[model samples]
Target: MIVVVDSNFLQNPMLETYFNESATNKVVIIDYAAMEAFKGDTLTSVVKSTAILRRFPRQVLIAHGTKTVGRLTGTREEIAKAMINDEGTAEFREFSAHLDRYERGVRPDGVERQLLDTGRWATDHLNAAQAENANLLDVFKELTDGIFTKEEISKIRRGEQEEGWVAKGFGLVRDLASDLLSRHPDGSVKLDPKDYYNNFIFRMSLCVFVQLMDWIRVGSPSALKPARLLNDRVDAMFATYGTYFDDVLSLDKQMLRTFWETDAILRFVYAREHEK
Candidate 1:
């Protein structure tokens, strides 16, 4: 039997001992990501390390993070947008123009960079997860299922009926951006209107991506209307990448498990060494 423990519970050494003394079992501890979320902490690190060592015998556990899988999935979409321009469209050119401007001695504000970095991080994790598992799609599905609900996506669509939801959603993104900016070593810088606009576009794309992932993970027939609308918009943007998209969509659970294991271990090691 395999026992999985949440990072919160795993922090207690006694709890780990209790499991260790039990019958012959294999342990898989998850969620080394929690350490990053909380920053470096000794207790979390120890728990993470202990769990990893027991990987050969009993399963140890940790919490992934506060951000739901659906949220991360949405972030993945946003990163993909930055990495892959719309197949052959005017927006593609527009996006290129923005990048050109940034490359030509145009420094983006802290918020913009933070948002971009966040998207990149999410993408890295997603790709890592996929590479680790043969069946990446199923794992993606499971992780996403835990974060988004059909009702939430429906609310987003209904929000389209009113302007407030868009404002609220944008507000949420902006607030998150602002928070990230505040933490940067350097203070925020003034941004050109065009650069700001580009950031907004990327931000919105990320929000939509996150919402759609939530829909895909938890959506039902009731969510079909909004899901269809969102899917149409995304599909219209990248018609030729259908096969690649489908391949990603079909990932399996094993990939997800491996993603968690590897991520957890790396995070655990990082936390342990850095905590002191």
Candidate 2:
């Protein structure tokens, strides 16, 4: 089994016990997991030495998030194989080394600045989520041209919509098509939200983010502060890559929920495509 465990599971000591050194199952150490460790207690709490060293001959595959799509591509992962063969992976390995130095009081000035910047972005994301929560019913109308009724929006907020509903209910692909003729188009051709199954990483990331907004809208207890949501966004990265693999092992209910939701979306898209 190719298991993708988010940063949460990476820190859990039990992970080392269950999977062991020579287990057949492969545990994926996504690119974000390493970078995410920099935020909290450095490498000590986020990922333990045993998690990597004890794995012995069993290779810990590092999965990189989609790169060419840039921000729309979501998070990146890099495996050991890539670290050795791919030049891009080498850059991330340097990040790992710098993180190690930071832990030892040799702060990597460049990476440290990047961590500070994430805080600013998280605050912006928080503000946006709050605004969207307030206008979930109306804001979508702007893009969708009022085709999505208030009642339907409410149903979706509650996750009540049935399978294959989005694809059929609205000319989703057409509607989302960018009005490239104008700079301020309803959408951009940079990425297509339709047929999400085909763009597994982007789709999974989108699902996770939308779910966060829904939680904020409904006042779900699981909905946490901006920093936590930022962490969940990291989980989204892992979840996105997880969809392309076998399974995900995460402690956070929100992360697991995001994973399940992404899987359902993938299945629905596949079913819809088959009908044609």
The TM-score leader among the candidates is 2
lDDT of each residue in 105-220, candidate 2, tens digit only: 88655765675565445445445644544444343335445455566656667777543445434344333322321222333335443433344334543554455445534754
Off by over 4 Å in 2: 41-54, 68-147, 157-159, 162-196, 200-202, 205-213, 216-225
Query: Per-model C-alpha lDDT, please?
Result: 0.36, 0.52
TM-score of each: 0.23, 0.58
What's the C-alpha lDDT at position 216 in model 1? Answer: 41
lDDT of 1 by residue, 40-101 (tens): 34323333433433332322222122122112222323522333222323332343444445
Candidate of highest lDDT: 2
Q: Which ten residues in a row are the worst by lDDT in model 1?
A: 241-250
**Which residue pairs show collisions in model 2?**
62-78, 62-79, 63-77, 63-78, 64-76, 64-77, 64-78, 65-75, 65-76, 65-77
